[model samples]
Target: MTDFQAIGASRKTANTMELIASAARRTVKAAIPAVPGGIIRTGRNAWRSGKASKVAFLVDGAAYFSALDQALRQARQTIWIVGWDFNPDIRLRPKQSSETLGELLLSLADENPALQIRILVWGMGPVYSGKSLRLFRESGFSSHPQITMRFDLRHPLRGCHHQKLVSIDDSLGLLGGIDLTARRWDEPDHRVSNPVRRSPDGTPYEPVHDMQSMVSGQAASLIGDVARRRWKKATGQKIEPSPVRDAAWPLAVAAEMTDATAAIALTEPGLIGKRGHYEAFRLTRDAIRAARKHIYIETQYLASFGVARELAKRLKEIEGPEIAVLVTKSSHGLIEKLTMGNNRDRLIRRLKRIDRYDRLRVMYAVVPDERGGEKEIVIHSKLMIVDDAFIRIGSSNLNNRSEGLDTECDLAIEAETEGHRQAITALRHRLIAEHLDAAPEDVRQMESEKRSLLETIEVLNCRERGLRHFAVDIAHGGTTPLPGTAIVDPRRPYWPLHRLRLRVGRLVSVFF
Candidate 1:
């Protein structure tokens, strides 16, 4: 036999062997459990399970606040808010309201003398930005005897309270990445330049996109418990649970799932003799590793080295789930550009090299310019949908801080039943449709015809609205961009001394 023929036969044999090995690896992953226990918990907190009578996904601040306004109007016994920052000057209902947040809360409290309103914000947040100080000075909650606001300062060094949650009457809960503050009040329309996207003083800012998950029933009560615990730690006073009333399910938000179970996961730093919890990290990692077909994720920060390593391992398999990550086009500020931007580049570069199946795609959604200037939208959502099996929505970004440094709360719903599966799938399609500027039904129909997600998006995307591939080549030891630019994005809870601390941390990491 000729040498060329022998080589051709040998190549065929190697290809067959590779196929068999890939199939075997998949079988092994499927058979073994990713998370040994059904629940993801840490030393401090246990995973709580409760039923959600109704779960609704609120896309952007406009939808979220509109629904929240209605719910707050119906708040009876108690109204609780926990956030990284609280701005009373920001209008909840921008079109209808002339009053600030403090006025609205005071009015409700005055009307119902028995109703109590409490707010807990991160202590150091106002010091980081002048906007937060304006919120502090302008939010007249102190004058009202019924309203109480406190700063949470019980975290380890460099950690901050980063959970955005609101629970009313222990019957309704709102949780996700959207904070009730300035620069987070845009609608899904996301016009290239909207007159409404401005601060109280009418200073315009770029359009931002974030998500919130609203729930009623036991799940709401569970989240309320979390808030109460936090308030106790910060205030040294325990608050009683509110009486459960008729679930204040928003009539405007169509219920996506009824009587569904929501898994509550938390991230808490170990401090002052209290154990730390990292359930948010564990839950996310397990979900991604268990995905069989597709894993869709939208996040603000992708700086977790552990998560990137896990994803790279999964991508190394010849055949596995297709990974699609939707991220903001750039870091928000100068410090973030140095820390998060550089870290993100390093992570994606590793993934790019390991993606052997051509199945990994990283992109950012853009609102295309009609007059020839594309407007970048900030993607501040922490969400993931795994093969129509489970969905996670919350304030936890995919970063080291969210994993262990900061405090976070996230909600996950597993599709154990047929109804749950359909709901999860529909939610995924709706989000993709929003990004592509197409109807959810169209995305569903195209996907049902066996088209890949990337293919469907490419076919539907036009010049007006679409997802643009985020180039990872720059991440591959390429020339980095200049830091400290106004156009680059900023960080949440921005640290003034980040540059100095970052240099110190890098030096420590090199030796440690």
Candidate 2:
């Protein structure tokens, strides 16, 4: 009996120790900022004309990896890759078929000897864990010379490392919606006949539309700093500063200003460790407040608690600028369509209540020519164009997760000069033009005619069903219990008590 009591006491003590350790780990992780300090700022006339920094745009996985490969090949010192997901098996250039990302990093480490490669990826669900996690662990454990990979699990409940960014040697940086993985491959032409793609098995995957940015000068350095801080939080290691080079890209850079100025915006839950990063939400709020003419946005989801309120207020103010939003018609999965989609519709109705359904327009991107008969084109790019001057791109969806429940990093550039503003406007035109399979000039002409983006889309949508109608149907296709209110906490039990709570929450979300 005494031995049994001793054993039970020992077990309790061990459990207490384990809990303490877990709490300590969480505390350390929470200390890390969802949006690092000195990353973003908002002000009146932020986009006013002046001599400012030069910015470039790089989109999708292929373009980003290509730019990284080039920058790494030329790097004199450091490389940083931050992402929600990173696949080691993914060949940066699968068409080249010469090297995988891991091999490339290994070779870089071997050749440079002094160069450091830091990879920060989300510590997502175990089911999503792939070869990258294993390779990262093995490399660290085996004491592989120069490459370092760390998993970011900073936010305990709702946070995720959703930023997709890469700074190469501190000289060049890439930012945007594209993650380094399969199923993300589309060209500027957006051809349907024969598109480039790669499957998990290295076969042909379907085409996807996405965007990214390539930045040089101080912007690159800024991104490098952001990456370093995230790395430190993840691994408790300090990174040395990497300086930028003066080399120029042959292609024209977007947001090329005469002045060297820009800002970085971050998004996550409300609080680090306690909640998530809401940096994106904060940035959007500030941007909306500052807008003078028009606020154009492209995002995956638009169902945030704070954001919806802000939009309603702005739309009702009557003094604020008009707003246009672009989002996916529906999530790819039916379950998401049922849950998230329903929530989105409720949010939309709320926005309409404020704007009286006039100052707001929401549209979805559709593959203009679906010769292959694909039912829908998934809209994945998270971007915003405000007053034809401010541009933002990142991984944050405009939802609860982005507001205060998930990790996200976004880049924002204000076109301070006419040339820079025009360039940014042209890029927006180009993106819309690509989706519509029309020329940029045509898009510009349509916009000049004072057509809502949805109206322009309707005109361009070749299908007899039409774009606006399609968007409406897609937005409406969900179980109408309450839109944007179903909170699925998978950890809960399958008992009737839990189901009752869920049903109650569903009903309450609709009214609240």
Candidate 3:
């Protein structure tokens, strides 16, 4: 099983809305894998599983953006974009064209009167806009009649709306961690300096690494359904699901896995007469527990205590699966260093201390620079693969907030055939190869020879542009976690909405 926006660009058409689902459904308190223990199951870890005719994984920002732009250019009916952040000014193909994201959508709307473009992002845009340089396009988005944007004030508490998805015409889906914002476009090479990688304002940022998956058929429609529900809740308007009549898969990209069933898991905090759900968290834990050989993870954060506890237990087991975690080691600014960085370091220390079997390896990626040195590439992807048995890709960070505080969604695929298993293993190997600058077949052969993931990596790692294992005493991130960790990385909702409603009503009666 697999587990898994900021703000208004313009205030003219910008409005904030509360997230209150119609019903107060009780939380499904099922254990990891439920009773009999399987990877993907509804009412347990996954909300639903839909069929996919073709699944293609875009490895980096360049591939993903290009394919997305291509798909958006071909859209016919509806466009749904749900993210933690969004920027209408950023260019999808900066080198090839100067058309910004806003212009593209507006142009699409102009082309087809039936087409509707809707974007929903987290309401707390100003909180992250400054640090992340999220563009606030005043004249953008709302300039067109068919293009609309809204802020989703999800949960009555300190939770976030963090799902990242883009669906077109209910036939093609682009689901991943990479948001359509500034400072996120980069090729697989991830050069230390690229003029074309600059933001809309000519500000150069560090190289970024992320992934997105393209799926066609019923699975893509399922993703559209997710976007529709969130849109309806945030804007209080129901949008009909488009029929999968068109061939919507991007023609430039090739599918890696065919005829696969994908499980869509979600995490929603308990609020507004609605019960909390942690299907993403449960799916992740179950996937980890189900691993028999190896577990490879790429995450932006590593501060979830529940996840850490399960990983620690697995590492302590003599015959447990080997784990390899790839994280970013760079400059995210002072605030991040003080908060998320410290929490991550604390978990890193614990994981290191408990990895008795030496089965765990935590590392960062780097690319060769022109100055004869290596510069680390930012790792912002949330991916996990368990010994080719399953693969997951989505927006859920391995942090406390992502477990239940935020609204999260993920797509997981379980290998049901020999070919599926091989494809899963191939993807893992391909990612490793990308990091190490080695060929996928070479990585596969090395692992085959070594019979261990750690050994294979050690054999492939080089002095330049390769993965660097984290030292026992890593720097920058403090050794001890800072105080008020819960404030910054909360694991649950801050306030129950029903309680807030009761208090508000009492106040109104007294005053009015």
Candidate 4:
């Protein structure tokens, strides 16, 4: 009961505290999934972990436009929209509201004097589009000085600024492949004969399917940061973030997950060289590589041999998971058809050869025509679902341009528990159901009954609003795109030919 006894007791307490700290560290390490390497990390995705108080996956233009309208109506301080394209005349909510996007923005600015609206759109060449200039001249967007718009031309030659994001009050954001433009508003029916599917000129466009996800809280702040950096880079003018306290989350759209972790990824010119930023590409590859049961992808183009190789490797595994890729039946124009279609065919053949176990299936979604025939529903959505554990939706396509040439942004969410996994699976089912024109519950039931995703799809497919198998004759050595076609669908900026001089320049570029 002297100094010696007291010293011994103090040492014992210290040892116990150290043990507790060590055990805590082990538990924390076990909670988070290990960062994957090899194929995924090799690409170097610019992945930054962020928090989302509320997250919702909105499918198709109907859901996206509706939710966006609701959020815009609630905006208090600022609104920021960054996209590959923008059509001011597009109706924000065709049925619920008669307001067009430009009109809505103007009205919001009028009502809220303190509100600032900034828009950044790609400076597409006339060969691709001149719609942005026409919109500014004809639409009422130019009438409002409070709303600032800029065309983003800051990119490598042949590259485009292809990220589509909308941030409201720096507390709510939406990001994905769907641009707020014309020919992007259709209900889940995806009815080929739908009257609302017509453009501003009353011309009917083909049916299309696309998706965008909304996030609130800290996640929105991170997206706002990205958008501001883009605005600065494109315009060389810095903008301040909004000071809104409450997020403008749409009341009508229910939150899919609360307190979830969301990762923001990017693809930029910086990622092309030795020291690069390839977060979007890396995250995508890693997610596919990490899949254990199934992989579902919806894309507009499939031209990247690197991505194709990764899939082929997985398909060649003895007990590999099933892979389902949904793409548009054909590209829009003749040149696009010749290039994108040819590339798609070549990749499918390569994957088919490695799919000795029949684990890979490729199909194009379709909508029913009024005359009892089926019409192609252009699938422009960039999405990937991996075994109910990971969900990625963004503007980046599974193509070489998106990987190295284009400026792109994407976001991903990884579920950590069984309940979360069920939510992810349900979201996938809902998307597939929308494409198939079947009930989400029905899709879930079919998938449960049949272990194979391809089998479930084969059984549930109907003549009306169904999927059509993609079959192409295996090319002798994979079809190479025609010569001048590269100028149209180039992996880099197209250089104009000036006889011998230009010919020499082109040759040098090809060799380099």
lDDT of 4 at 215: 94
Please identify model 1 stretches exceeding 4 Å from their true place: 1-33, 36-46, 131-139, 474-512
Candidate 3, pairs of clashing residues: 5-83, 5-84, 5-85, 5-122, 6-84
Clash number for each model = 5, 24, 5, 7
**Could you tell me every candidate's TM-score relative to the true structure?**
0.86, 0.75, 0.87, 0.85
Off by over 4 Å in 4: 1-43, 125-127, 138-140, 271-276, 475-512
lDDT of 4 by residue, 1-512 (tens): 43223433554454455554654554453323335432223235555667788899998898999999989989888899999888887897787667788889899999989888998887672126546447557546765778887777666566778999999988998999988887788777787788778787788888888999999888888889889988886766788888774855778999988887788888866522334356887787777667778999999998777788778767655456789999877877886787777778888877765554566778898877889788888889999998888888899888777876687889888886676678889898998888787899999999899987877777778647788777666446564444454565554433232234324433433332
Model 3 vs. true fold: TM: 0.87
Candidate 4 residue 155 C-alpha distance from true site, Å: 1.5
For each candidate in the order shown, give its overall lDDT on alpha carbons.
0.77, 0.60, 0.79, 0.77
List all candidate RMSDs to the true structure. Answer: 7.7, 17.5, 12.1, 14.6
- Model 2 RMSD, rounded to 1 decimal: 17.5
Higher-lDDT candidate of 2 and 3: 3
What's model 1's lDDT at 381?
Answer: 93
- Overlapping backbone residue pairs in candidate 3 total 5
2 or 4, greater by TM-score: 4
Candidate scoring better on TM-score of 2 and 3: 3
lDDT of 4 at 453: 82
lDDT measured at residue 346 in model 1 versus the true structure, 0 to 100:
68
lDDT string, candidate 3, 395-423, tens digits:
89998889988888899999887988888
Please write out the lDDT profile of model 2 over residues 355-440, one tens digit for every residue: 43245666665553556444345567888887677787777677666654455677777665687788777887777676666788
